[model samples]
Target: MTALHSSAVTDGDGDGDGDDNGRRRELRVATLVAACCLALVAVAFVPAPVGAGDNIASFWFNPEDTEAAAGDTLELELVASTHGDLVGDGVDELAATLEYNSEIFTVTAIEHERMLADGDSAVEIHEHEEIDEDSGAVTIEQEREPSGDGARTTGPMATVTFEVASDAPSGNETIEITDAEAILISDYPQGTFDRDAHVQIDGSAAAGASDADGVPGFTGIAALGVLAALALAAVVKRRD
Candidate 1:
């Protein structure tokens, strides 16, 4: 009877050890799965490259119009409708023509190239130079040519970016795109330049205007906030 009891105790010990091992394996798997899920979620939050049908030709300034004292700098953005192939070569080639109160200012172009694989967008600034009024006809040209390597067979698309100093002649200023040009891919949809033109003034420029804090324009920020909340919730659930 003593030997039988000893054997029963040994069997129970073995069963408990097996159960512990099973539980440990399950926990490890769950942890690994959770890690992979987190990695995927991180990738999802990354901005995707602009693809076909993405509007790259048109550009606009946020708040469209604003009022500022002379010498005040307004941060403007050149937003592409799509993250199209044209970004590979560069975005600096695009030009901006600012006309205020008949005084024209041409800003030197700056380009920020983004790699599609990395999901990064580039920014180009046209700030260094300002063109004064031109009595002769001023030709605003966009000399965008694809690399002959055929890598850009789909053609490239991008927008011009620049800032406008409130140096207007202290009066109601009217800004308009005197002209624009772009390279087009025969097969792809050719984006219209007409949408790329506009002007803005301070406090009372247009019906729809927002401050630089991006208050009224919260689309991008709102999306990111929602995604962050979801991720936080996932982490809490996993910990529990």
Candidate 2:
């Protein structure tokens, strides 16, 4: 009887120790999983370093793409955005050359936007614009007078009006910004930039005018369909 009692106590103690070890292992695994999850969440919420994100200031074209017919007039704005942060505490001066296909487009005029003024009534702006159709280029240079007078904002740097050539062929063309330079009020040069405006032309109207006088503009496929419709009507009439 004594031996059985001792064996029973020993077995109970062993079972209790095994249960305690199992519980400890489970708790350790749960804690590790919770810590891993927290680390992942913290990493996800961290912000990206500067110059690696969209927070940087830049320039681009408004209406990045457009469609028009031959002889149509289109306007494109040179857009500048400071993104409310560094690299563009607002630009005090801008200079860029716009390049296009002279055979497809002609520059009609250029108008500067009051980006430099930025609602500061004390600042005056001096602007210069030039267009060379033969070279298919337009140049714009604008600066705030009494240089470095700040205008911390974003807006159009300029608006360019273009006339599609009367005989421009159908397809897509592009206008690009080049030799670009931007200056901040602090005399700091800006290097961030974006460019290019795509223009899609519908030359079917021009083709129809040349193919048939006083006829409505029609694509080749449309003209063929009409011819097929006429032939079907004639065949039905003959059959009747």
Candidate 3:
């Protein structure tokens, strides 16, 4: 009778041990799945660092031109396709133009305030250079600092903005802007304008179209898509 009772107790202990091991295995698998899901979520939501190929070949001094007027504040907003702190390094050149009387009017300005998209900090370039031209093409070169803080920092993306006078030429003139000889240090592709990117004159507010054979405008949709894909991956991983 004692021997039989002892066998029964041993069997109960073995069963409990097996149950505990099974529970532990399940817990570990669950933890791994949760971690993978979280990683995917982070990747989906996090915006990638902008690169040189993503740079805008051209943008309007006044996109909508809602308030373009002679003697008025001609607000020139540069809509660069690429936006990041690292853009500063890849920028090889910069140019701006205002068309008038069948001729193009180009201006030169200094790039200032290397601010981030989040507007948290400003970067300083080691070298600031500009092209010397009144019309046609202009080039700029600068040495940009790398990203991150302290030692072992990564490269920074080139970022720049220009401020031009609103006193544009009149009488059938078109204000054209182009980024001349803009080089990218990254492995991605680079581009330039052929005839130049133009904004119509005659005090009319309209969006400028790309030149016949020029690089198309950069949109934020690609980045958004990447994020979405990452999110989907995370979801699938968790489900698995």
- Using lDDT as the measure, the top candidate is 2
Candidate number achieving the greatest TM-score relative to the actual structure: 2
True-structure RMSD, every candidate: 21.3, 8.3, 21.0
Candidate with better lDDT, 2 vs 3: 2
**Per-residue lDDT tens digits of candidate 3, residues 104-130?**
333434443242211224444454445
The TM-score measured for candidate 3 stands at: 0.33
Question: Which of the two, 2 or 3, has more TM-score?
Answer: 2
lDDT winner between candidates 1 and 2: 2
lDDT tens digits, residue span 35-127, model 1:
999999989998887553344455444435655434344443433332334444223233345444433233434333221112222322222
Per-residue lDDT for 139 in model 3? 39
Candidate 2 stretches with Cα past 4 Å from truth are: 1-56, 83-89, 204-240
Model 2 scores a TM of: 0.60
Stretches of candidate 1 exceeding 4 Å from the true structure: 1-56, 82-96, 102-132, 135-171, 185-240
Winner on TM-score (1 vs 2): 2
